[model samples]
Target: MWVRYLGFVILFGLPGALHAQPCGAPGLDGGYFVPLQETYSHEIEIIYACDSGRKPAVEGWWATSTCQNGVWSPEPQCIGEEDCLPPEIPNAKFNKKQNSWYNEGNTIRVTCDNGYELKNRDATAVCLNGTWTSVPVCEISNNTCGEPPQIPHAVIIGQKYQASFAADSKVRYKCEDGYSVEGAESKKSIFCISGSWSELPKCSRGTRQNTGHGSSVEVTTSAGSGTQTVGGGSGSSAGGTAGGHPTSTESGTQPGGGGRGSGDVVHGGPTITGSSTTSVSNDRNSKPAFIPVNECGVSPVIPNGVVVQTERMYLKYECNSYYTRVGPDTVVCTNDGRWSELPSCKEAFCVLDLAQYSGIGIRQTGKEYIKEGETKNVYCSYYDYVIFTCTQGRVTYTRCCEAYYHNYGGC
Candidate 1:
């Protein structure tokens, strides 16, 4: 008996086996553990499974809990179908295989409505940890345009009927009589490039006539008001010349001598005199404002890819794992305020197809998927075997055979 005690001590160590406490039932709800026992020793692991049509609240159908310090670590429990409901997405719906409630590890595919596309091409969501993965978003395609804006005092040249327009469609605007486009010599036009329209043109009063005396005098009248503006130097009054800047004083006097307003002016500078005040604005030192051109919007989005902005107008594209990038990776904002041709990502692996080869034996009947640079083994017979490798969706294989296998020409 003493020798037997020594063997027990050697196997389980000294004080831990004798002093360590055991754990009682884990008290799992909607599930049960295997190999039931009244108490479990420390560090003993038990497999857990849920009832029919149920799965562990965790990621997988089955789970394992360990007994530690007189308690179960995870305290396993099962989740019902109500835990996860079908994901709802705008402008999109799940395919026919969609279930009312998805179990853990189940996947669902979706299709977008007309004129809309999935944010991530061919993306699917999987149920995990009692929740669903990120669902694909539906967005309007970049090639369509909404209704064009209306221009004030101008009408569309053609029929004003359609609610929406296709990409690259141009709409011409004709100003009403007595008003022409502010700076456009030809007809005003705005094009619907991509998904937005170009800047709209403005219309204003046109053609002002000047008539005065031989002392370089000019007279003009306001549109609706009877106020008259007279400017010219009469041999030496320090008045503004017809085409030159004012040097001493400028005034705007109401016709028929109703009221007069006077203001000081800078030498060799343009001046503006209003009818109410006696002050004038000097614009000799003001610099011209600059406007930037070709401002692009947010960068284009790609499925299974990421973008890194290298500059204000340039970005670099990179594909996720198991995908191959096609076309240029770097794109720059063009002069038309649009991004260059965007790149695409293609799956870099091939699905296993044994239909082309004869006498090939596979464990499964349907197709098998694999990433690039991975290999799959095929059995042709007792003495024949073939190893296949996938690269960029193409599959190639090599055969190994003995003397008997070579003579039999495989299965």
Candidate 2:
């Protein structure tokens, strides 16, 4: 009976009948295992024990299967948790020394240097995960200066001038001779970059030299004034004296060589000059002293027999009236010595001659009806067959045209 019991025990203890020990099974002594589940698709944490007597943790997911005690179990997969975290993007710039992180959204900003404007958008950026999208580079904007003011005939020199500029740009200025600049000279040389001109410079009145001897002199030669002194003397000699000094000398007479007689007399002329005279015997006749010509005041006098008159709206001159038309009208000189031109006369109108019936007479030369100085032409016909037209006032030829007296009874 004891032998029979031993055999039954041996049969139950066979390799297939007893529980099989796990080869690399993870458990409480080495590491903790997270059971596989559909919801847990990512890496699961596994706490494992190392030979150093410290418990270490390994992360992995279920990879293979195993059988133990007639039951099948899922294998725990081991991998690094580093991969679970998102990858670190390189070359990402962070401001304020802030560290980049995953799962947390952050942003970054960019700027440019002075004198260099940003070419890209000035204000936005983003942080995705631990990385940032490549942002466009900030470039320098174009530099420019605006055009200068419109000073006609002015020239600008440098290429630095362009349309986009601020105020206070400098520009130069210059003007032609007869004209002068008004504003600040230095400022004129430079203009505001914005194109405005500097203050204008002051201009002075022009001057001219007069026609006589004094150093500085001015004369007003208008129509009324007969003579203006403009520096030189007129009758007596007034200038630098014999002592090399300037002086004005009036009329005076010197002693005569023979006997002291009455002194020679000198009269004033238009121009001034020095005169030396000596007394002579009253018995001897003497020529008059030298007198200067009238240089300042002299106007030409109109001569007689010169025809100075208006004809056909023009000035006409005739020495004799024999070859020209003669009339009672004439030009004359006024008391002021100024001559007047002949006035235009009135025209003559045709009138029927009751006695001669066929011929027409001047009803009244419209001369009587015309205004004092008005002019007109006159037309007449003989026997209602021939036509003649004459200009009133001065002498003029009679003109004959085909239509001279058409409707006024045949000429």
Q: Which stretches of model 2 miss by more than 4 angstroms? A: 1-145, 158-161, 176-179, 183-187, 190-411
Q: Per-residue lDDT of 152-233 in model 2, one digit per residue for the tens?
A: 4444444355553322334454543332332112113432211232332322222223333322222222232222222222
Give the alpha-carbon lDDT of every model: 0.59, 0.31
Q: Candidate 1: how large is its RMSD? A: 21.3
State model 1's lDDT.
0.59
Rate residue 243 of model 2 by lDDT: 26
Error (Å) of candidate 2 at residue 267 is: 48
Error of 1 at 120 (Å): 5.9
As a TM-score, model 2 comes out at 0.17
